[model samples]
Target chain A: MLHEPASQSGPDASADYKMRIGVWMFLLYAAIYAAFVAINLLKPLWMEKTVFLGLNLAVVFGFGLIVFALIEALIYNHMCGTHEADNKGGE
Target chain B: MAIAIFLTFVAAVLGLSFYFAAKTKSASGYFAAGGQIHWGVNGIAFAGDYLSAASFLGICGMIATAGYDGFLYSIGYLAGWIVALFVVAEPMKRLGKYTFTDALDAKFNSRGIKLFAAISTLVVSVFYLIPQMVGAGVLVEPLLGIPHYAGVIMVGAIVITIVATAGMTSTTYVQFIKGAMLVVFSLIVTVAVLVRGLSTEPDQGGRVPFYKYATLEAKEVKGALVVNDYKVLTSVPAKAETYVKLEKGGVQTWWLRSDKDGKIALKETQYEVKKADGSKLVNGLPASKDNVLRQNGGLEAIKGKTGPEAATGKVGPFEFLSILSDPETRINTWKIVKLSDGEDKVVVYAPSVKPGNKMMRPGLKFKTEGTPIQKLDFLSLMLALFLGTAALPHILIRYYTVPSPACARKSTIVAIAAIGFFYVLTMYMGLGAVINAALNPVTDNMSAPLLARTFGTFLFAVISAIAFATVLGTVSGLIIAASGAVAHDLMDRYLQLGHTEKQKVRAGKIAAFVVGIIAILLGILFQGMNVSFLVGLAFAVAASANLPSIIMILFWKKTTAKGIAASIVTGMVSAIGLIMFSPSMYDKFGLNPATAPVPLDNPGIISIPLSFLVLVAVSLLTQKKEASAA
Candidate 1:
């Protein structure tokens, strides 16, 4: 029933994942920050409503999910990938 | 590969338990890291312990469903931390042991102190524990597509195993992982929102429109409604539809669409007529009923609908706003419904813009746009949030995990950093769910997960697992508290079992299992209630019930054991009683909410002060304290 995998390197699993995740997250943060400031200043001469998965422009933006997703998909996945052997097998 | 990934995550955690369990050979190691964990690690564990199902699922769901008002909870939760920092954190570490009882009995060793403190911890922790287990049950359904009961059992078994095997050692690490992941990932989600930018639209990919027709119930009678929260006019087919009878001058017909790419097209038809003047009137209370106040629509627009289940009556317009802004009205919400179809339900919310305000969300509350009630609601909520943090039991216990009082202080700072950043993200997460318009109607608890789902199944899986882990981490901490009460406070301190350390550890493990079972039962009992709101109640109880005793004991040297006993019993009993007769509780049990006796959304404003008063008075009367008990 206990599902958390033991890291071969111990707490370093999360720490390592955290650092890598932090880097991508910060990158995503910077990109979003740049975009927010740019648009407010430049106000984009002719803005078109961009659709994502069918959602409107205003609804699509935020920092948490973007930074978080990169962390999970890129950072944790990479760090934990090599440790798949430790995961419950044939569940 | 999909199953593999899921299994891998689960197996990894279990393996860690085995590893930690191996290292956790002593009682101290199992219960508070033998007071030896790193400050940084303990800090994250604090986050893990604090950010339970209620914080992630309940608050996020409320925000997604309610709008700006929903975020008030997050504010209350974070604010509660300040109390922890200045009041409980340092001194608690200084006076501490395995449980809060030890601290109280430190100066005056009396049975009265032992008995009452044990009861208070058990009552509060049990009250708090139910939701975590129930949330766990609720969580597994979407993840494994399993039934709720099965999920509850699964979580119970797993938690028992983790606690039984490694006790506090593994629990601490689990919490740390969860707390860190939640903070970081939430930050990531916020960044995504900013980069993705705001949208005045809905996700069309898999969004469904079902509010085309909804049934409202009052006193067991049900009626069909043609609900349309239309911003622009669009005609709904009359072929099989019963038209809404519009008065001559109401806010005549408006269109309701889930923004630009709405899957379900909705419209509203209002015609508020004037007597050559402007006013509203309904059956009598004012034919001017604003869309008649959707019980579910107060925050944003979706989940606030009122019915037997949460999403039934569109809960009329201005319902929650009335609760939030008004002092007399306690929201009596209904339990969740199965909906004949059995596909489960979702709520779709849309945010509105009102100028010159600290926050935004439209059609939510009249007070929002410069109303006196709105200001009061904001103040009440803000006051509670700021003072409520440190009073929480789960949050309090994290302090003892660190090696020294110095580390405990440093850990709080780290927690503030992590927790603060996450709270900032909750705003975007809530708003993201709203504009995305791809939200679950029945269980507002599903907001964040549903939001992740809008992005893709992979994100959904990851978020769900993380959220599940969140439930595990928080529930584990809460259960630990309960078990400590049983083993450390009741068994040893009160009952004087005098069992060796191994036996004490075993008793705690057994107690954990019992508490876990109780939590599952409570989760099922309070099915429809939002986890976070309930958690807020828990915090209110903790603050009211435990905080006074702790504070008074720490400062007042003349404190008598009887005084502490009286304060704890009074706080627990009063809070539970107030909650029982609360409009929210009455409504959930399918009773007329009008019968409720309490007058406030939170009892802390009154209860906290009452507890303090009781403690002081009793202390004064029972002075020269210890001898009387003998």
Candidate 2:
């Protein structure tokens, strides 16, 4: 388990760092998701255009969202782990 | 043989539950699985729990019918999990002891918070439970040839046994197994769909052609509706009449029913046998003799080159999508239209041919050109789906089953990965059902399983059995959540019963039994509705009621106990109240739905924002102490 040792970084500082990382990641995802919805509402015709192989713009964008989510999760996990390790080492 | 396979799956799951019962002797184990479940198992269990019948059966059926419109829901649902992973998971695991109510009450320890949060949990769980039970009844009907009520009762009993015996331990294991099975089988079927490719030709052995029948006059006889002059017409104009073909004694006859008034409506048709004595016998074809499943037909090629125009044979996945986007592929889609009655009454599903390119776009199902109210309705549904997943009581409670905050976060990530992959596979499987002609005319929910049946009977049997298990897993989770709200949060803490651990466990088991019975009755009452629609209602409720309270508490320092309690009640009541007076509910009451006060079908676009406003208003009035401390 990843944790900040109490002797080094206090609980409040550790929680603050974790909260910032979580919030940033959430905002990044929300932006991408919101963009997809905006396209559907404002310019639905753009979704019908074929972008890759036989896949249309709507489909490619959807697939992009799923892939982006997985990537973001991995990045968040790794960053949070490294932050916890650095905090523990400071003791 | 299929029945045998189905029963075996049920028996094995039951035996697993009974075995786990021994380990759940303590209150903690019964409610939270002792917080000892491996993160990996719990991750897949989350997928299993979240991917109710709506995900597997409903989405596939929607795609099979409406094309890309159904896949939009997949994006919305998966996106909601991102909120859970980043915002809710770690804090939830750190704060709560067992149920979701425990998490919100962690700061204030107020009885009012506990009372309303528990009530919110129960209402949301019950709302979510009905769809799973209804989907269960639907699956049982086609698989076992039993009545719909019997299937609902069987699922209720099995899920109750699972919850009552081993509680969260058994529920977790069952979800893990079923979730893994659902993903793997969906992948296999999707690959099979790709390999088979697209075809324009109808089945060779059983080619049922179209015919038009003569109009029959209807007259009132003794206050009963009766029709006369039932005969098959040989010839009619091609464009303006309803056509049907009937086969008798290995001979096929074509009949045309004209569009003129008093024309015979082809409600249904069967064979009548004439004996030597000039008497006629009307009866059904025997199931044993006529049991072979038939392939769906009516798909035709609209845009094709001379070579591929004949048939694409076996195309690659990219090639398949490209071909479907071509304008020449005409698909027969079922459309429900209103008749002269003007109300939603006389709803009839008329078959219409749509070009492939149009089907690949959004306007086929959710009309964008309609009035602003219709557009708002679409946005409202999307908003609910995008926000609902994290707020669900059953999904929230799963965070407590893991050992640490890290485990909770890891499990959510794993769930997103697994769920995301399965949702992608659903698009292919749904489209496969469409081109393969696997739709049951009456109910679109049968699309995925029927597509599996086209491969082989054993695959069909396995898919059907797993779908039933899907219902059981989800329903059990919901019941556990509901029972936890009753025995742990409400009765023990709020009511000041202060029950012992042993007493709490006993009370929880009893609560599960009672909730399960209520779910069964509701399932039977709401038969024939599409499972996806019902699940949407549940999501709206969860998003409106629980989400505002959770987000406000986690971020807002000024949030008081009264604010949280008031928001929970306001969100729950407003969403449900709007639904009750909405047009859909009016239709359920056999009243003129157009006369309903609420125009929008989904209440989230209104209720969610209203909840936030109520929370802020209430908190400002009651925030003296909390504000001073901050």
Consecutive 10-residue window with the lowest summed lDDT within model 1 chain B: B337-346
Question: Measured against the native two-chain assembly using Cα atoms, what DockQ does each of the candidate structures obtain, in the order listed?
Answer: 0.02, 0.33
lDDT of 2 at B7: 98
Write candidate 2's Cα lDDT for B43-104 as tens digits.
99999999999888888888888887888778888989988988888877777888888889
lDDT of 1: 0.59
Candidate 1, superposed: residue stretches over 4 Å from native: A1-91, B1-4, B204-384, B624-630
* Residue lDDT tens for model 1, A1-91: 1111111112222333333443454355445534532332243211113334422232233323333333333343344444433442422
TM-score of 2: 0.87
Per-residue lDDT of model 1, residues B1-630, tens digit only: 334555666677778788988787655666676778888888788888887788888877776655545655665565455456545665667666666776677777778877887777777777777777668777778677788888878877777777878888888988888788788777766555444432222332334322322222211114223333322222332323322322223443322233234233333322222232344322112453243322121222223323323322222112322222222212212122111112312112222322211223222321333344334333434444545565566666666677655466567756766775676577667755654554554477877877766666776677777888887787788788788878877887778877887887889889998988887777666665678767777766777778888878766777778898898888878777777877678878788766767644556666777888999999888775455555
**lDDT score of residue B571 within candidate 1:** 80
Residue B354, candidate 1: alpha-carbon lDDT: 23
Instruction: Point out the worst 10-residue segment of candidate 2 chain A by lDDT.
Output: A1-10
Q: Which ten residues in a row have the lowest lDDT in candidate 2 chain B?
A: B338-347
